[model samples]
Target chain A: MDLIWDGLRKALELLVGLDPEVLGITLLSLKVSGLATLISVVLGMSAAVAVALNEFPGKRLVIALMNTGMGLPPVVVGLFVTVLLWRNGPLGFLGILYTPAAIILAQAVIATPIIAGLGLAALQHLPPELRLQILSLGATRPQLVWLLLREARLPLLAAVMAGFGGVISEVGASIMVGGNLKGSTRVLTTATVMETSRGNFEVAFALSFLLLILAFSVNALLTHLQQSRRPR
Target chain B: MRAPLLEVLELVVHRDRTPVLDIPSLRVGQGEVLALIGPNGAGKSTLLLTLAALLKPAAGTLAYHGEALDTEARRQAYRRRVTMVFQDPLLFDTTVRENIAAGLRLHGVGAEEREQRVAATAAQFGIGGLLDRSARHLSGGEAQRTALARAFALRPELLLLDEPFSALDPPTRGGLLEDLGRILADTGTSALLATHDQAEASRLANRLAVMKGGRILQEGALQQVMNHPEDPFVAVFVGMETLLQCRVATTTEGLLTLALGGHEIIAVGEAEVGDPILVGIRPEHVTLSLHTDKTSSARNQLAGTVTKVIPWGPFHRVELDCGFDLSTWVTPQSLTELALAPGRPVVAAFKATAVHVVRKGHHGGDAAQT
Candidate 1:
């Protein structure tokens, strides 16, 4: 109990002291996860709207496949992304392996399915007659899509949080694809793993505390947005 | 009518390779409130959607004011000229003001004028106090009022309604119906109201089209369709509750004598002697008398005994056993003055024109006219 207490004391000291190394790792983690979440949102929302609006053959099969993708193992995604970016691989010409870009690419793959599945559900939950009613009001196609998305904005915000939560807390893909290089590719998750493995309990505790704070802050902001506009 | 306001030609709609609607031709004249009435799944809603261009028909040509809506751009432009209200009162998750302003915004109305029109339309619908209230929290009737105000704010050239009052409670439905009837009369806004209630059709429509199995069986003025139903189905659907099967006994110039249960009745219509026909008598057209008057102008007066008295709104339906079963509507005052009761003797009287004759075994391609 004393060791834990001492470790927390030292961690708070490090956080308050504005340690440059800790700050760099935290910012890098945010940058990688934020970019990945943004990419996933764009790709996921487009795919979801396309599937939910139009009816064609194989619709059920496609939805089942997307649901399966939502549970895809991050380690498997890391393995594939590593392979695609490795030297002498098909995409090796870009030479982006063992870098932050590689980690972001892997993280985006991990988040897209989560965002898409939730988005599809959010859009489908609306009343079916709403589309015809809007069109009958003389709305153009783009205006229709905008209005529907606005109606589903609350659920979509939840999708963003879920996507961000999944990617930001993911460590396996970051280590495998990023190589966890010091100062260049290091993030909170990778740094915590490295410090804990080296028996540096105090640093690891600090990093974990920072990670929890970051996740909660981002989610708290989104939750505020999602709930503030609720009907009384 | 010459130079119709809207026309539909050869409209066909299919679902899963099976035809759901196959309207060959129909038209609405200027300033006319045309009602398309039928039972559920009779394609009244589908026809309204098709008229709004929200559903693409398998084959059809739709024209407005003699101008054809042939292309996508033309249809887009045409949509701005009309608005549709659904049965569910589908309002957005916003304030009532925004919900009503949405259509006007889509039509590119300026902000100031949009606000002004929203206010005027809300007041017109008697929802002025609900302008800023959240639509999600409104009662069903208030939500429906918001939906109607939203459509009327556009001041569209044509309005389409799909059972707009069918989902409300009786009192709410009656109030809305009265307000809508008054608004339509004051504005002279051309409209197409789709419903299954004959009372609604009679109250709001200048013309009536009766539909069944995706086809219109008859279409004409309310009185014409109600009195002279060309088809048997139309007779029952139009509230002609009293139908007596009789054989023609004699034919003269523009008149026929029909025999029923050893009784003879005079009717002015076309039919052949010895031909079996069905006589449709509307309950409202049949009057009851305690004593048969020799000076009465009614050609058909039959003595009967009142069997049952069922009280309806403002009137009582008096069932009679006059050799053949018959029913007639009488006001409460008259029911009291005449001392109507079971086993009471009464004379059921109606003019010859009040009875409609439908030739049996003729409801195909063209009714076989004699």
Candidate 2:
């Protein structure tokens, strides 16, 4: 009880005092996750549009694979990414291991399927006649896609939020690929893990509190955007 | 005659190895409104979609302005000249103004021109006040109006309407039909409208085509097709409720005498004596009354009992068993004045010209089936 109360008191003090290291870790977490989410959104939405619009052999198999990927274990992804970026691995020629770029690459891989699965669902929920109607309006193929995306903007935004949420709080992949180098690749989740392992309970608590606030603030803004454009 | 603006030759559309539309040569001339009528699942929509270039026929050649649209580039260019309005008013999730302006934008019209056309079409369709409203918030009629405004804003050369008014209430459908008729005439835009309602087809189309079993059974001027349906199936489908199997007894001048049950009726046709003929008469053309004056120009007057009185809006469909079942429509006022009811004796009168005669051997021996 004393440990928890003391931790809480110190956590509040760190937050109020605006600890530079804690702030830096939080900003790094946001920057890496935000960039990963942006990349995933572009790739995921393209895949979703292709999957949702066209009919081809193995379509069901492809969709099943994406759905399976949505719930993939973070530790497993971390393991695979670590092996790929290792010095002797197949892709180590670029020499980007133990760096922030490695963390972003792994996070994007983790979030892509989640955004794509949700985006496909969002597009499929629209009326089937909408595509024909847009074509009847003389829309070219690209314009048709643009108009459909606009029509499905709400659910697509939800997909973005989900992708962002999936990566920001993830510690396993970030630690494995980023190496948690202080003042370089250290993010809020990895820093929290390190502080706890070092018996710095107060700092760990402060980091956890800061992580929650960060996630809440980003999600709150995205949620605001999603709700404001809702149909009356 | 003016060349046809659109021609469909030997078109066949299949769904999973089963052909749904097999139209052999149909044409729509410039400024012509052709209504295609058929029963449910008769492939009217498939035909319309094929004409709109939205559905590619498995086997056919579509000619636009006498040029074959064989390649994708030709088809795409043809599609830009054509537009369609489906039964459901599929509006995008945007403002009504934007929805109406979308097609113009796609056609690469300048923004100022798009706004002008959208504004004009909105006013024309009586949706001016709804321009700024969200499409999701529109009622069915309003959404449909927005859809029409969108289609018309493009000023397509050939408009294809697939039962655009079928999903509305009767009053709304009637109002929209009247406005659509006026719009088509004002713009001189040729169109092919597919619908199941014969009345709508008759009211809006200069020509009518009756489709059945994936084929165009008959096509001609509206009155010609309605009055002289080539087959018994067409007669019955076109709402000619009274079909009687009669044998020709004799001919005098331009009229032929036919034996109906025990009575002799005169109709305008030329059939050999002792030949079976199918006579069709619309219910509305048969007049019913209580007194048998016989002083009018009607050549056939038969007495019978009213077996059924079906209440139609502002009218009644009274079925009489005058040696043969003769269906006739009478106004409610006439019904009340004549005190018409079931089991009451009444006289049904019709002119010789009202009866449409089809030979028994025409169109695959379908005369006996009716």
Predicted structure with the largest DockQ when compared to the true one: 1
Deviation from native of the Cα of residue B108 in model 1, angstroms: 2.2
Model 2 residue A64 lDDT score: 96
TM-score for chain A, candidates 1 onward in order: 0.96, 0.93
Per-chain TM-score of candidate 1, chain B: 0.91
lDDT of 2 by residue, A116-217 (tens): 999999999989888988888888889999989988988998999999999998999999999999998999999999999999988888788888888899
Q: Compared with the true structure, what per-residue lDDT tens digits does model 1 show for residues B273-354?
A: 8988877788888899998878988889999999999999888999999998889999999999999999999999988888
Model 1 chain B is weakest, by summed lDDT over 10 consecutive residues, at B361-370
Each prediction's DockQ against the real complex: 0.70, 0.61
* Regions more than 4 Å wrong, model 2: A1-18, A197-199, A227-232, B362-370
DockQ score for candidate 1: 0.70
Q: Estimate candidate 1's alpha-carbon lDDT, on a 0 to 1 scale.
A: 0.89
**Could you tell me how far off, in angstroms, the CA of residue B139 lies in candidate 2 after the best superposition?**
1.6
Candidate 1 lDDT by residue in tens digits, A145-206 = 88888888899999999999999999999999999999988999999999999999888888
Off by over 4 Å in 1: A1-8, A228-231, B252-254, B288-297, B305-318, B330-346, B359-370
lDDT of 2 by residue, B95-114 (tens): 89998998898889998888
